[model samples]
Target: MEIKEAIALIHAEGLQAGTWADLGCGEGLFSVALAHLLPPGSTILAIDQQPVKPLPYSIPAGISVMRQQADFSLTNFQLPALQGIVMANSLHYITDKPNLIKRLAQSLTDDGTFIIVEYETTQANPWVPYPITLQALTELFREAGFTNTIKLGERNSVYRSGKMYAARISR
Candidate 1:
């Protein structure tokens, strides 16, 4: 699913973020949306290992989309406390999640929540490492310090794909 739809889903669940970071943001769709949807004086930090191109949409004054072309490794990131950290459709690409999640928890503000929206990879080859089960993902995050796990919704009933999931991790 697109980042806009993901952000829309977050909004439907009544999560209003004053400061949003599109962590591992590829092109900045959700970052742009957060900039637009958030209340006045809010900011959206669109960070990625690659720089996002100039968006088709204009960035509002309050939004600060920092295009960081640095790596996403935990050792590389020096995250300051942020309101919301979004891991949208990019979890599988991350090599080491446990350490990353711990860093994320530490980087979050007192009232912050980490949001992870990922694709439902079907169970297939056991020896392969591409797809991981929902339970596995939850356990990984829980082990990393996330407590609340919930299945948010299905992306759509197509190709028997797994449902979209979101978890809230308190700092």
Candidate 2:
């Protein structure tokens, strides 16, 4: 998807500028979008196991981006307390969703935001090995101690038959 579409998926009002981590930030598309939503002086930790290319879109000034080449799915992985976390099209790669969500919840500051962009289907394909439908996602986050899971937006997928949804989770 394009940068504008990515931004629309997760945009919300009253978002403050703070440190945000984009796990599995492939190409930094959603990372750039998150940066735009936050106020200036925010920092985005664009992380993936592979090297992330330079951001394709221009972020607001003073929004710094730090790219980290690490596997975020690992249980032993360490992360600082963050105001927000974005996982776009990345959670499907993980086989154990509950533990991963619980671990990530611990990484967030109180009143933190967890944004997920995923396909709204249960059928797994070669690309999506462990798909989490919206219903399953809500249950998973609820089990992880989150109190709310609000769907921000959805769009028809150009590549897949199912729709892509973006949801904001909170404690």
Candidate 3:
């Protein structure tokens, strides 16, 4: 999806002004988009295991973007209290899914939201280690203590010609 469209989808999920995180933020596409969408004084933690270089483009003033390199699978990795977290096309990489979800839940505030954009296929490949359908994702999040889960948007996956969905889960 386009960056503007993705930002709109996130906004539709009732995102509030506060700290947010873009876990496994590759190239900072959504991270930069979110920085633009969020209100002034909001902070976005753009994290990935790989080092992130400075953006070629400019970011507006009053929005803090902290890029970090850390393996999220390790329990030692720290995440600040967040109002929302976006895991766009990233969850499939982690071998320990439940543990990561639990840790993400612990990092969120009471009213925090977890937004996920993933493929809607059950097939797994080398690139997609743990492909999960939307139903499975909702059940996983539900088991992790999120009471509400909503579908924000969907689109055709260019790589596999399957479907990709964006979901919002809340405590």
Candidate 4:
């Protein structure tokens, strides 16, 4: 997706300038979008299992991104308490969503946000092995103790799999 589209998908009001993590960041597409909206002095930790390219866009001043190669689904991986987490096109790869969500919630500070961009479909292909729709996403996060959720935006998928939706969840 384009940077403007990415930003529109996950942007929300009242985002504080602080540390955020993009799990399964790939090449930091969504990370760069988040950086655009974040206030100066924010930092992003972009984690992916494979090597990632340097983010393509020019990031905002005072914002930094640290890339790390790691499996974000692994329970043993450590992260500092963060202001937010972005799981753009990444959560579906995991088979155990509940456990991963619970573990990730622990990595967030109180009032932390979780921004998710996902295909709103039940059918899964090789690329999205365990997909969850927006309804399922709300239930999943609620079950994991997240208290609030709001749909941010939606777009037709370029891959033609289905419509894509973005949601913000918070505790």
Q: Largest lDDT belongs to which candidate? A: 4
Residue lDDT tens for model 1, 1-171: 555675565453555556667787777766675666566666667778775677665777755666656565657677666777877656666657777777767777766766666656655433223454567778887786666666654455244455555554443
Q: On a 0 to 100 scale, what is the lDDT of residue 114 in model 3?
A: 86
Q: What are the models' TM-scores? A: 0.75, 0.97, 0.91, 0.97
User: How does model 1 score by TM-score?
Assistant: 0.75
Ten-residue stretch with the least lDDT total in model 1: 124-133
Q: Which stretches of candidate 4 lie over 4 Å from their true place?
A: none
The clash numbers for all candidates, in the given order, read 0, 0, 0, 0
- In candidate 2, what residue range of length 10 has the lowest lDDT sum? 51-60
User: For each candidate, what is the lDDT?
Assistant: 0.64, 0.90, 0.83, 0.92
* RMSD to the hidden true structure, all candidates: 3.7, 0.9, 1.7, 0.9
36-150: candidate 4 lDDT, tens digit per residue: 9899999999999998777778888899999999998877999998999999999999999999999999989888999999999999898899999999999999999897999
Candidate 2 local lDDT, 87-129, one digit each (tens): 9999999999898888888989888999999999988999899
Candidate 4: 10-residue stretch with minimal lDDT: 51-60
Off by over 4 Å in 1: 1-4, 12-18, 58-62, 122-129, 157-163
Q: Write the per-residue lDDT of candidate 3 for residues 1-171, one digit (tens) a residue.
A: 566776765555336789999998888877877777777899988888898777654677898898888777788888878998989899988777888999888989999988888899889988788988889999898899987988888878778868888888897
Tell me the spans in candidate 2 whose CA falls farther than 4 Å from its real position. none
- Candidate 1 lDDT at 90 equals 64
Instruction: Pick the winner on TM-score between candidates 1 and 4.
Output: 4
Instruction: Show pairs that collide, candidate 4.
Output: none
